[model samples]
Target: MLRGAYLILAGTVIALPLTPEGLADGPWWPAPAVTGTSSGERYHAVEPRLADIIERREKAWKAAAAQDYDRLQHRSARLNRLLDSAIGVLVEGEATRARRQIRDLEDDLRTQTGELARLRTALVNAPASGCADSGGSLVQDVKCALMPDARTSLQADIRAVERRVAELRAERTRLLSDLTGSLQALGIALPASDLEALLVLVSADRLIDTYAAYRSLAQVNAALIRAAEAADGDIEVLKRYYGFHVVLVEICLHLHEAFLEEIEGKWLPRLAVLRSEAEAAGQQARRLLAREDAPELRARLSANVDANGLSIQAADLYAEHLRDQARTATERWAGLYRRHQVALNTYRTVALQGDVLSVMRQSNRGFAELVRLELPPLRDFESTALRDAVAELSERLRLSKL
Candidate 1:
């Protein structure tokens, strides 16, 4: 019946494309494909905003370089403040974001200082060919004559801003990961699997380290998030999920290891009980057939009656109905055996999840060993540093092994 149901479902699905008006004639069960929905769009939109801000910042910086000393001072101060705001805003309240912004700012500041130094040098080396409109003061004439130097310096400053803008653009490539981490830390509500989201974030925030792949971090976060979500936001959720998943995994492994146990412990014994009745039924039916000896009775015995004394010849004929008048225990048991086979498929699906965890656990152990090797020697390793590195991994291991 189940096979027939699946065949019907399959036929319906295959016929969908052939129906007039596309999906109009299809069954109501198939969900319509909604193409425009995408959660990642929001993240992509934010990237352009960051890029624009960086661009405007660079423009203002160039305009500042061309103005007088007083103007340059004021404009530079404003640029600094704008950069500070950009760091805070772009980070969206993440410590790692803050750190990255700080690095960018430091580079910008360094470039600014270099430009300032170059401008000062140009002013000092002003040519004897004085300013065309200067009245009397030598300094005034020199300033006027070196006006082009100031303009050159301003252009260079503009280029520096452009470079900063480029850096900001590169930064966005990893912004999604940083944002996800920050959101997770801040307890922001986002609709998705936490593990899936964290993996996306980790992939976005990938490091340059060759030994460590972004996937490793993603796996760790996925396990952590799954544990937390499974526990429904409880601190102990991690502990319980790990425990339950591990136990489930162990049970599956044991089952696989001793598959014969099912036959030895249950199936064969049940079959014995079923077989005894079938054998007795066969004897009775044979005796009945022998005594009758009529052609009709002999034909009935061969077609409808089994050698095992039962009226039904084929064992499967008793699967659907069994009147109280007849004893076809063995045939009934055969039905139970077939049903058990069908039920075991569900068990195997859950068992596969446990197998996934086992594989991940082994991989994690190997990676953790590599991380240990990469850490500083004992003299360089501070207690706090060592403690922090292992804290989360140790917690995970404890939970998984439970």
Candidate 2:
């Protein structure tokens, strides 16, 4: 009876057709209506500019969506061929794989270098004499005297690690040189140093960095298949989906850029001034403590100095914490933007030739849903007091949609 019931439930689910509600259930639900508040009111003030941006993005997306699916398919195929050729050149003679190994070895070398430095410092600071017996056991005093010997052992370990690190660096450098030569032979102009190039790319934008680090040609091929499948073989739908994500990415990027501008232009400078002020206050307190001889007056001045120092320290720490928080928020949004881009691009490629409905029912369902979902962080950021103008603009955009 239990087996029969389970079979019946499975049959029911299988019989149910995919609907908008089903798709919405996964991730792409419509944005919630923005509620009114003091913050929201302030956001409304900049609604016109935000509306203009959204309208312009929507128009561009509509135009792109109108392209022929067949043409897109051809373009996707060409891109894939080019990408595979590049990967072929990279993996020739196992050069690509070697580069990856070299990267790992370089990381190990960095860790070992830091360890060696620390060990050297410990050796330099090792006590010259044994610990004095201050109501301690004799065994403890003997162990304390062995500190210098322990330091010597650490120094030896450091030397061994240093040698290993040097060997790894040499191997990595040689592999990198070989890889560079191979790519150049293929008419691909890659940076002389793969690691340094990766660092520069990653620093510019985390999302682009992920795409650039696809690891293998096969992964890139799979990604294109997934993208085409997501759009259900419809060029128009794929274009709209791509445009929507582009808008989201733009908004997220703009928000982060604006926040960074405020931080660098205002908050950071203010923090620096505060830090300097705190240092000055500390120096003043130390001098006062040294020079002042009056009992009651000295006591009052010392108390004032301590209080001032504590306040400044607290303020500096709080500012630093805010800066860290902003950075983390920006990184989170950047990562999400990249994921959206990947999903859209994959849909664009797959829409050219795949079984749209079949693929959608399988792997592409979640991808479709994700494209429509409003980013919570972005929504919350829009509602903040600091972004009153932006919030106002966003609210206008929402109302215009209604």
Candidate 3:
């Protein structure tokens, strides 16, 4: 559904070829000052009103930049603390902790497994029930007693036990996987005999596979942590990257709101006026055509009326297209802003809790990948105008270390 919506929006953009001036005439265009040319040569082309807003907000921008940097520093400090805690967990008998956890999970699994077996046995032995009528006169009340639905009850009980067993088994698998990975990460390998005893209920091949997968995941986790730590060390870089991203999101949001306001306040009113004019012109043209007498003059009048009608139709189409564009752009910007906000909030929370590993997990793989790929040099994101602006701003901030 989302893909189809985006395709439709892309088609709209491709189909409509409005001029920059036309777009700017309404609130559809982004603030010129915010998207000023890179060489600083085209700054004069910016609208006076937008330029004034940018100039007035210069101090605010600097303050925001500083605040962003401070926030980055705070996050870095928190991450450092988290890293220390993670290292502590890794160093302080992680294997022993994993073994204990695995043992507990195994015990729970055993209990659940036994419960499942008992439930299944009871289900098989449960009595079937049937309703029967005792022979009686047609007018007399029949004394019929229905047996309890023991089969249904037993089946329900079996299902409940099965679900519990499945949950316990899954938990046990997770615990074993974690323990295996932690031990492998620490370069500790249990002997085959020990593994067999520890995972007595599990199959040999499955244990081997789990051990291998755990080792691979442990390596990945270690590499991600190392990268995160390295990035944390360069607090200025992180600030610049994140600050630029935030600034872009802010600009997009501002532009979206401005476009919506323009649609409501300016465009809609213009459309309404155009609609009224078109209706009035159509009525006038119809009356004139009805009274026309001269051939050449009538033809000229008819052509003029047709041209007017066509102009109105074109105007209506253009206005509708603009409306569609505005709606699509608003949704796109909102979605982008939401994704960035979620990433930012999650980072802050997880960093505070010193759970960088949690952030690196598959559950947060998207965010982790973004951090790894985006929080680097500005040169990588020079494709689009907005990205180029972000790259330039990031470089400038990094140079000033502000």
TM-score to native of every candidate shown: 0.20, 0.33, 0.33
Candidate 3 structure quality by residue, lDDT tens digits, 130-209: 32132453432222222336666667677887888788777766766676665554343554334423233112222232
Candidate 3 stretches greater than 4 Å from native: 1-22, 25-244, 350-402
- Residue 46 in model 2: lDDT: 24
Candidate 3 root-mean-square deviation in Å: 29.6
TM-score, cand. 3 vs. native = 0.33
lDDT of 2 by residue, 1-402 (tens): 011101001001111110000010111111222232222232332233333443544433334553221111233444333332332221222333344455466558768888888888887887543344325867766676556456556666878988887887788778777756644432234565333332221111221111122222122223333454566557665444333333323333333343454445544565556556666887887788888898997898788676666655544443554465456656754554454345445444545554333433333222211122111121122122323332222223223311
Alpha carbon lDDT of residue 37, candidate 2? 20
Compared with the true structure, all predictions reach lDDT values of: 0.31, 0.40, 0.40
Number of clashes in model 1?
6
Stronger candidate by TM-score (2 vs 3)? 3
**lDDT comparing candidate 3 with the true structure:** 0.40
- Tens-digit lDDT track for model 1 on 1-402? 011101001001000000000001111111222222122322232223334433443233234242211111244554334333322222222423433453354346556656666755664675544344457878886675557444455455666756765665556435544644544443333333432222211111111110111111122223433333545434333333333222222221221212223223332343344445566766666778778868987887765343343322222222111121012223323332333233233223323353323322332232211111121111111234333322222222223311
Score residue 98 of candidate 2 by CA lDDT: 46
Say which candidate scores most in TM-score: 3
